[model samples]
Target: MAKKMGIVALLLFGVYVLCMYWYIFHSGDGKIPSALQGTAADPVMFMSGKELFLSGEYSKIRNFLFFIATPFEWLIYFLILLMGVSRYFEKITTSQTKWKLLQNAGYLFLLSVFVYIVLFPLNYYRYYLSKSYGISTQTFTSWMKDGVLDFWVSFGMSLIIVTVIYWLMKKSEKRWWLYTWLLTIPFTIFVMFIQPVVIDPLYNDFYPLKNKELETKILSLATQANIPAEHVYEVNMAEKTNALNAYVTGIGSNSRIVLWDTTLNRLTDNEILFIMAHEMGHYVEKHIYFGIAGYLLLTLLGLWLTNKAMRPMIARYGQVLKINKISNIRSYPLFLLLTSILLFASDPVSNYISRYQETRADQYAITLMEDREAAVTAFQKLTISGLSEVNPPLLVKWFRYTHPPMLERIYKVADHEGQKQEIPLKEEQKK
Candidate 1:
């Protein structure tokens, strides 16, 4: 049985590599011809001064290693390794316990620690690479502090999630998938709503933008974009990273734009305005709500597919793997493996949706701010500050990029005539 499992694993690994190659390359040009005013033929020229800083061999090596971690490979090996540990744990814990739920939580915590150990080298190297490349400012101690906090938070969440999931599975053998997925929708929405406010503050300091003049300038752009934001925030990302970013998150009253301090200190005023306008575009277009809806649907389908796939595999491998049932705590490694495989399969579709939304937001920002030159210039700064590839391999972009390349963005701005600014909505008019 173990030998057969090995053969199956080898075959699956081959399929994964081949699928990654074919599915990524054959995906399409991903050009958005429908939404934008016009497609630009040329990308914005990168700044000559920062050429070596961003495109140098050092940056290339880091970027290469970064994407390599993302192909869902590490989790597969972890899944295999943890199966041995899972069986050992199941055997040890089987000695009658009154606190079954507590025992299960301990099992999860044990597994989480094992996963942390397995992946720690990659995690630590990423931090080291950041510091070596002059992108990280946080001390190693501070970085480890953040990591430990993240681990505890994940462990806590997993304890609750696993407890409920297994409870459902035990109650109804077949209907658990439906029930679990239905429960997941709300759980996800709640997490998204709270993350910007709750989870984010744990890692970084976020304050209202200290520069009143800049805050007022951003307010003007928000007014133009119809974002009902009452505050503009600056996260003290200068303490941790040199990368520049601004994003809009949360729902209703929680919604706001957060600019990294690095961006505030590094970009020109015109560039900042364009960046804020881009984030505001996301707010006005209701991308957050739409994203939640899209994810809910995708998750529902994903969980269903996982359930279908696992049934056959468990029938064949369950005894050898020591998983007595779907609800068995020992089966989590298998569940994780199947889910990771499904997520990797779904990446091309998810990324395509993300790219279109991002492209539209860029166009919207250009038109709303009415600054074509700034749009081009801002992307150039972003490419340098972020060390973005001007035009990555088509396959890599298809599988990974949520936004269009710097070359595509700059050229698009050049081609676009810009959208006419719409009148502000009535709700803001009363205020």
Candidate 2:
């Protein structure tokens, strides 16, 4: 049964890859609306003809990579269990230590290393693609350094979380899922609280925005939004990538308004202000809190489902998979495999909710800034810098888009400006 399931998983992955390749590469780029095109002096053009082609190709390849990576991750976990690699690691760890904590750590370290090695090729290809497309500026050595740092950080966190989860399972097999879910609420918050101050500094240097004039303007905007930001922070991302970005991160006192140096160097002051306003809108609307709440709810559902599904699967295929029970450390791969499948299944629903929140943030920014021209042009520049598809395929949009498509965003802002202009013209006619 294990062999059959693994084969089926491989076949399904192959079929999906082939279909996605044809769908993404064979399909033509989305056309720009004729009316939306303005001249160089009053430009609304998001991309030139050459840029449109390049962005389309780049976007398609990126979407292909993203769509494949999730299923591939599931397959990796499934194979680890099906092939008894998890059991092998379990045995080695058990032989090495009598303490359960030490054993668990040893097993997880081996698993993490194995998975990293297997996935490194694909990860490197992603970096290579970005470099070839003139997106990534980092050298291979620098990229590898960051990747290693990421792996260690992730492994450390997972070790802690997994140890607690297994401890809960040992305490109460039936109620472990509920207890874990409850624990995750505080754990998730703690991670978010510390992430900005602790984890982020590992990758790049962050400091107060050096342009005091621009920083003052941003702080003023933050004040208007009622965000208690003491300073606008900038990260040195120009050394790594050419992409322009800004975001609001963390909660309460840890919350930070961060801009990539790439963005500051590339965009005008008004454009930067519009982007800052958009990020501020996220806080003003309390989207972060809402996001956290939504995540917890989904996690609760996922954990419950995983518990329900895992028991039956173990009863049927425990012998074949070499996992005797849920509490057994050998079952770790099965647990992760089930959770990953659930997460993959929930991607569309989660992405939809995310897009809605993002749209609301955009609307808030537009209303707060009241500068439609800046908003539209800023989005255009962002699309160019990122080589983003202005209008992606429906499947890609549904599965991957956390924000609205660039074309949709620009059009909305342009239409809002038109309506505002028409209101005054109608008042004059009535007078």
Candidate 3:
């Protein structure tokens, strides 16, 4: 049973989860938007034959479309249709440096736009699902604005990397993948260092957590965890969502723990502290830097694999898709599509590493707090508030879940032998 759930969740829900994080690239925000906010019923009402919206029964089917079916559509569209378009575009650009580079940018832009068009339905359905779940609060106009902004950000960043990658391929021919892999390590680190300060603020408002009292408790936890104390932030997501989340983003001086304002409002002080400590565990464990290393390493492997496979794949499908050279601007989509397919195949490996890290953090939180009951209670609240799947099959756990199920967390926290320490948060905040 556990293995079944894990497999289903990994192949199906895992894909959706990947796309879910890809959007905001973090957990959601929640603050009461309009007076109607948080008061509105779920937009997706249960059918007569279905269980209640929050009963966990609806999760299997609802998630089937969001996490599984729709994502496949986009994947196919990119791999098959877009690759065809890319090859067609490549036929026109002459192999001159200035013109070819110029054409590469132009072709890349067209591919992005086309991919966006093909993927929009899935994206909209994602928004619809969030609204249905009563998680999203933004108006349609606002949602569209964010979507556009997200696209432009992706396009601009991808353009820079794709252009450089293809240029290296043009120059090195045989070893371009190695050079590109080398470039991404420093590039990835630079992005991690700057993302919190530069990119996150563009979509949502962030302020120092509003409750000074709770802020003090978080700082104390940080001290216990030996993490920096100054930079806890509250994201203004109340206007856009009711989902509760907190995550550690950025690195070094730029590193900070960001909490959804909704989390602060909805969860108890004990719960919030546990969540923060879990995040602090990441820093204490140096998981972020390690994660970067792991990703760059995988990317290196993926690039090498793609290079090996490209000749045969293009030979088999090239005439059909319309391109000749691997480095052709139009053939770039095939490169991307193939690499993504490779990564998708290996998600289980990546997610397994993530789950271990998250469990370590959970253990850290429980031990540091020395409050087993609070830890269990915190997991319960997190599951209830987020409507998380509590007993996902082992497959899902292996591939889709970054953290263990709430049920597993409860047992782990309960079973661990740790010291008892009295701390603040005996009385809950009024909110």
Candidate 1 per-residue lDDT over residues 219-267, each given as its tens digit? 9888776666678999998888878899988776777689999999988
The C-alpha stretches of model 3 lying farther than 4 A from their native spots are 1-58, 66-83, 91-98, 415-431
Better of 2 and 3 by lDDT: 2
lDDT top scorer: 2
Instruction: State in Å the error of residue 422, model 1.
Output: 29
**Which residue pairs in model 1 clash with each other?**
none
TM-score of 3: 0.80
- Please give me the total number of clashing residue pairs in predicted model 3: 13
Worst 10 residues of 1 by lDDT: 420-429
All-Cα superposition RMSD per candidate: 7.9, 5.4, 10.1
| Whole-model lDDT per candidate | 0.73, 0.86, 0.70
Off by over 4 Å in 1: 7-44, 49-83, 93-96, 415-431
What is the TM-score (0 to 1) of candidate 1? 0.85
Error of 2 at 271 (Å): 0.3
Compose the digit string of candidate 2's lDDT tens values, residues 1-431: 77788888899999999988888788664555565444211222435666666887888889999988988888898899889999999999999989988998999999999999999999999999999888899999999999999989988998888999899999999999999999999999998999999999999999999999999999999899887889999999999998999998898799999999999999999999999999988898888999999999999999999999998999998988888999998898888888998888898898999888888888888898898778777887888888888778888888888898886787777654443232222232333
Candidate 3 per-residue C-alpha lDDT over 261-323 given as tens digits, one digit per residue, 9 for 90 to 100: 888888789888888888988889999988988998899999999888877876775665566
Where is model 2 more than 4 Å wrong at Cα?
Answer: 27-44, 416-431
